[model samples]
Target: MACYRVVLIPVDENWTPASPDDVPPQPPQPNERLLETEDFFSAVREAIQFNQQTWSERKGRWAVVCEVGCPGKTWPGLRICTPLRYKIASIWWPPGWEPNSPLDMPLCICRTHGTLQEDQLSYEQALATIQALNQQAMDRASTMWYVMLAVENEPVSRTISYDPAGLQTTVEIRRLHVAQPAGGGHGDCSHCPARSLDCSMVAPA
Candidate 1:
């Protein structure tokens, strides 16, 4: 089962009600909740392994693991396998691809369905669900493209990097570009292809 603990550090400035010492108590700072239970680690490990196997079978390639975190951050105390330690990986996939293709495979359990509540599913159950979803996708597709697997303490701090060989497994990751469609009717001049068509199309005098 997954267990999490949120630590609160008092911030002097933000704490209301001045203390007897004539100083305001600080607001509580949030610390990363540590995963302390052995069962929790086991579940996480199982999930990772299940995801890895699912990706490999569906994509025909193993996911790549990447090291993350600052030098001194306490090892979140997860009890996963050694090889998977400190290495967050991903299964890359192309966009708009067929099912079973790497492109259509689910990246991770956490990603497929947002982070779990404090203690929703045991790590094993989460992994199992992820594997089941991935297999379902693979069973439907003939050739998949790419999939990415990543691990990080917080989603914001997570980043995608290339391997030592300077080779990238994913064509593009975490980067998005969008273009507006052309205007069809009048008045939307900014997107009009033809410059002659002004706001009021009543032929210029």
Candidate 2:
């Protein structure tokens, strides 16, 4: 099962990055309104809504964590700055899910960066391509290629560093098991190309 947590980052008006290339403030001001949930996607959905409504006018951003044992339960998590497309493809698909179509994907919004418009266009174009690909006849081997293409096309985060002394409250971090799609045409990955590759043979990244 995937575990998630939402932390509200307090805004700093006087604090600005020393350089344009500098990274965001580590761990972000003190995290408030810590919320935990077992459902990863649902947590993200709530974060988006929270940002749209409350965080829009506020100075800081709300971050969602996959909770993989990072210090203070930060870093290795989804911050407000992370692109929504990357969040969906990277976080959602590994749990043995297959979208019926592009429409199944969730809409992502980032009020802090004012990226809602750009992300909307990118989201539409990406889904449109995926839809077109779905119409084509694909050999089993090519199925994984479809997934890889979609993932590689999206933007990646510059870094994954959060404050080492992150969360103050007690938090449990655990490994995320990538579930396998059941066989006999019952599971989401029944048609996935991941089946062709042997997990044991693949080296860990």
Candidate 3:
């Protein structure tokens, strides 16, 4: 299994503008950089695969809940960081319908500050923790949640929404790590053991 860390971002649904036309344009998060198109796509694909693997391994035989392959490619939630508007807008997607504000755009970011991560947290641990956080936060229409994934040894960062459907603990780490040569979808990543994703920016523990 690849080792990685993640930063969690909370979406604020209450942001409002004067009118629909005045709605903030979607773009990359402020101070943060955009992962290349291929990198971003690889992250998304790997994330979906990771989530599916952990959930199936822990829970045993679950159905897919995300529209990952949807023709429209919908986001898991509506709330987003404000600075991430244009980054998302750069892609072909439909405006997510959010509650209470006509000017509310479907983007899933607010600000790029105060990112939290626990490098020790594994795929199952992160998923379980985020689910709990969402449940405690409750069903709020104004906010969308995200988990930025950093492969244990990979340098690139990618974002995923928090899934509220479950809050399961008790993960059994079926994957046993052994030293392997460096290689992944993005080619050789000398930083850490090769997994599905490459490592260009991950800090070793």
Candidate 4:
């Protein structure tokens, strides 16, 4: 298991825009940077340079470090520092619709900051946390929520043909919500509006 720390730096200049756009601004997208370690200040400086020189934008003023991947041992929860957007699958993905295998089903209920890991938090929690936080206070970065999760280390085996470096077996650490409510596709929502056409809790006829 590996613990990766990455800083999610914003690309917009004004932290608080005058007005909200018709569609809310999207969060930063995570990349292989989670696996790379340069340094804190160095990473931030690079982000600033990239924004200024590459994109011609004077952004990257704020950044928050997020721990990605899994730890060796079991942990109760993980804190997500970046601003995340809560989302659910549309009616297009009607209940019981498994586009892929169970392991590969698309996200139905999840909290995300466009990162590699899906930070699962109820919509109520996500809304309240973002509202309570003072968007202007960079010092309150630590005042984020710790999303409860269940971590498992599974062993996997694979066959390799190359003899020079034959390493095909490894242990994978999987993290998931301890007990995601069945409501999204299984039953009534624990906390949400009454089932409607657009409601995620609605089941297929």
Top-scoring candidate (TM-score): 2
lDDT of 3 by residue, 132-197 (tens): 443333355324433333231211223444458865444321111111111211212233233344
Tens-digit per-residue lDDT, 41-157, candidate 1: 333333334333433342322111112231212233321121221211233332332342212332111222222222323223434444454455457652322222222232213
Instruction: Estimate the lDDT of model 3.
Output: 0.26
Global lDDT of each candidate: 0.27, 0.35, 0.26, 0.30
Candidate 2 or 3, higher TM-score?
2
Task: Summarize candidate 4's per-residue lDDT along 1-205 as a digit string, tens digits.
Answer: 3332443334455445321111114444433242234232233234333433323342343333333442212121222322223322211222442321111222343443232235544445533433333222223433222222222222122233444577555444333322222222232233333233343221111
Whichever of 3 and 4 has more lDDT, that candidate is: 4
Measured by TM-score, how close is model 1 to the native structure? 0.20
- Candidate RMSDs in Å, in order, are 23.9, 13.7, 22.7, 18.0
lDDT of 2 at 162: 48
Point out where model 1 deviates above 4 Å: 1-69, 73-95, 101-113, 116-126, 135-205
Runs in model 3 deviating more than 4 A are 1-37, 41-106, 139-146, 152-205
Which residue pairs in candidate 4 collide?
A: none
lDDT, model 1, position 99: 41
List where candidate 2 sits over 4 angstroms from the true fold: 12-27, 54-61, 66-68, 72-125, 137-205
Name the best candidate (by lDDT). Answer: 2
User: How big is the positional error of residue 70 in model 2, measured in Å on the Cα after superposition?
Assistant: 2.9
